[model samples]
Target: MNQTQLNRMKDGLGFIAALDQSGGSSPKALARYGIKEDSWKDEDEMFDLMHAMRTRMIKSPSFNADRILAAILFEQTMDRTIDGLYTADYLWEKEGIVPILKVDKGLAPLEDGVQLMKPIPDLQKTLDHAKERHIFGTKMRSVIKEANPEGIKKIVDQQFEIGKQIAAAGLVPILEPEVDIRIPDKEKAEELLLKDIEENLKKLPADTKLMFKLSIPTKPGFYSELMKDPHIVRVVALSGGYSREEANQMLSQNSGLIASFSRALSEGLNVAQSEEEFDQTLADSIESIYQASIK
Candidate 1:
């Protein structure tokens, strides 16, 4: 979490394929990609498929980390050994890709239908382990399903609190507070979201190092303040269910918010394609997303 690493985290397109999806999420995501659940009889089968997808992306002949600055990984994937190297180190050594670990234990329902991350099992211990493995950063997620001020504040507060702990351990924290795209009044919600976050941030000591992984703003430039904030190392946008084309369009219009996309990045990749075709599809996706990030 030194300046060099912080600069890299802020520098290029981020791929977030780290999905330790719950039972419900797995099937729905598979279905979205036209994968049939019956093809996988058990959770282990599904996980094998998930791991394959991410590893394919990493090892693809067309894989380029020049624009793919970092990759966030599921904890299980972090431990995976490929070619005698831990996956994190493998990515770093082979592609110059900094690997980040997904540390949250998924979400639990909160009051007013909001959600917060379930308690991470031994969070400090996990951070220590990640640092030892040379993982560059950590990411945790919470949701803002509505525009309620209270809910937004709660998300920001909790993220900053946990983020401080991660930063103290010398790992950068990617604080993701995703605002669900289904809601109307998204522009108003963005304004309130930034306002609340900014107010809370002011109370922290001036040196709190953090980063953001937010939903694409409803309006262009909604996150201008964040981009200008010195305490923030970077501001990245989540695709949040947008199609690849739509996410790229919105991302291009915004200044300073680079993509840390998960589903959108995986949208066109197919396990069934010929190797040449698959590489071309992946190359095209990475180049397009990379272009948007530089803009």
Candidate 2:
């Protein structure tokens, strides 16, 4: 992240994504990662996590500079039954806040049994569902990640359909292309993939935010092609899976904004005994991201 990037992050929309789980893994994963509470099984524990998460956000004051503060969500993880969705600022037509609902494979059919990894048609359905249900962020919704070029096209195609239908309803489609950088060399692959993204974005909604999730061989060069596109809104570098520093560095490089996961979720792994644990996490997440915004 650079000074300019820092400015952009502090001044624009940003978020930390959440897991999309529909299994025991939901609770177990949060716990395994130490981000959950023993009360994960107990209502009090669930509420505690929620309180901590939200308090953290408030303390962080993410919206102070007009930045979008939120827990991004994937289809599998959007199950509100647990402590996840209740803390959302945008649920049910609320204002100045909203959860970034991640449109995962669940919205679209795929070759695999899993919904989190497949491609979906139009992400508008999720946005609409949020509105009908009065979920916050009533005016917008964002999507992330398609494994490859084909997946990118699938996502853009859906956004295009929604774009054409905006008069009837509206949603913001975010294209998250998970970039697996080839440390030593893989320019050809990088170019090939970024090219597809550039071309697709040209035909999608003008409001669409394109994010590049790059890990190794860190540099904007990996996404050199896409970054050059006039419409690309943000380029985020993520190492995924457990390295909070990786994400922080990615955001810190530009002094950009980041969404914490591994560590936040890790709280659940320690077997939270009660609500206090959950409350503390939320309060921490909000503060953590706030710091990122200022960094």
Candidate 3:
């Protein structure tokens, strides 16, 4: 790999805090902190609450950016200014943390009613916006709840297709096809998922660079082959509803997997806590997740 690519990969180490939860997930999450969506009654009111939450989330990395490589943000949070600095600018210029954008619209039904993220109809427009904001990369998510070969293939192909577009626009794509951990044949599903990824990756240009936001494998070291490919900037594990402790334990056994966790990263963070307490809790979360990531 060239020096630029090497540095990009190295900088991707440690935890990537996922602060991008759209639609139902966003309001539902805020409800946990007593900021109910239904009570807001208007987009502006709801956005006010969300902006408050984003401020706190961004502040978590203020004192120590060592354990956090980047943060993935929702479009709503991306443009907002915090204390006169845009959200992305605040993270990168002030905290030295890379800022990534979540580019996919939420899931829609595919064949057999299988859920997949609808294509970003104006993805290039979004990338153009991201470029103006100085965002570092992009992330999109799809789910594989069953080991259906046809569905898996479609998911992988679509993810790669869009990933290539993202790369062409000069931003790294974190292709996340998350397999539900509740699936019974997790090992089989994982094997097939890797197979699909490998097949698609082989057809891409030799210099294409990307990242993988994967679920914790049923077995440790399941991603060793992926790690050998230099074009893969990082292989970040998603918590998939696991508790922070559970996620950390699973990540600790994996050789080259780090985290890009949303729920798990914010498991203990709440609005009720004092500012000092919140910062401490977030710092502790980063430290624990970081240790496991590099294990």
Candidate 4:
């Protein structure tokens, strides 16, 4: 479908995650922590050990890209410090990949919880720096935590001011609100969430595009129903631990993107794990959706 004709939505149904990546830095032994001079020049062994130790963390595939990408807007200084934001920043540029960053309503600027965030230039600067680094996506997770409509409006408004420039760089601003777009028997959830969307999504630039991300196995026609809401441009069905076969079967039934945490399936990476399951999940997902994408 053409860009204008395509639903502004580009999010695949849901995100596939195994654990919280932000809990802490990659573990290091105090021996290696060397207070400025161990010259553990057996550096080769230390490197091997470090690789073996943290293999579990980076093996997930999606973890590193996702974390570094979040620096686009959130205050991820610690992450930047540990990973060298600029180095990590430059890698995604060559890949043409813009990873999605989900945020609950609490992290939003328009709410009471945001009282300590001043002028909020931190997020904008981060995003701008990412743009300079050559990133393409500025994605955020959305949620409705406030009963006040004005508060939601404020949140989206601030997000727009911060993210609009990123879009100018051909980087899309994805507002990934974590809610069930379709509630079969329970219409109230959809109603309430849509209400929040309507109030908060006002006054957007004409060039701005918004897409919603939702988990699957919701009510049967839940996806189509969610599409009925004008705010959502497109919908992506996410698979949580659903195997390649199952997820492909699901994506075959739809017409949107098939996203997978394929990077996590270290099997394909052939790193620490034995060759069990390759990163075929990502391939299968993209193939299934592409096939169905054809009339």
Per-residue alpha-carbon lDDT of candidate 4 for residues 110-192, written as tens digits (9 for 90 to 100) = 35312111243455566555545444444554443433345444544555555455455555555544432232433444444
lDDT order of candidates, top first: 3, 1, 2, 4
Alpha-carbon TM-score of each model against the true structure: 0.92, 0.55, 0.93, 0.48
lDDT of 2 by residue, 37-72 (tens): 544667545544544443343334333324443344
Summed over model 1, clashes come to 0
Local accuracy by lDDT, each model: 0.78, 0.42, 0.83, 0.39
Ranking the candidates on TM-score from highest down gives 3, 1, 2, 4
The TM-score between candidate 3 and the true structure equals: 0.93
> Per-residue error at 33 for model 2, in Å?
5.1
Candidate 1 C-alpha lDDT tens digits along 1-295: 5465567776545544344444446676666555778979888888677677667778887665766877888877777776788988888888887788889988888655358778887999999889888888899899877778777788888888898889889888889888888888677667777987888678767877778899999888888777888788788888888888999999989877788887777777676777788788888888788777667
The per-residue C-alpha lDDT of model 2 at residue 13 equals 57
Best by the lDDT measure: 3
- Residue range with the least summed lDDT across 10 consecutive positions in model 3: 1-10
Write down the lDDT that model 3 would get.
Answer: 0.83
Question: How many clashes (backbone N, Cα, C below 3 Å) per candidate?
Answer: 0, 45, 0, 11
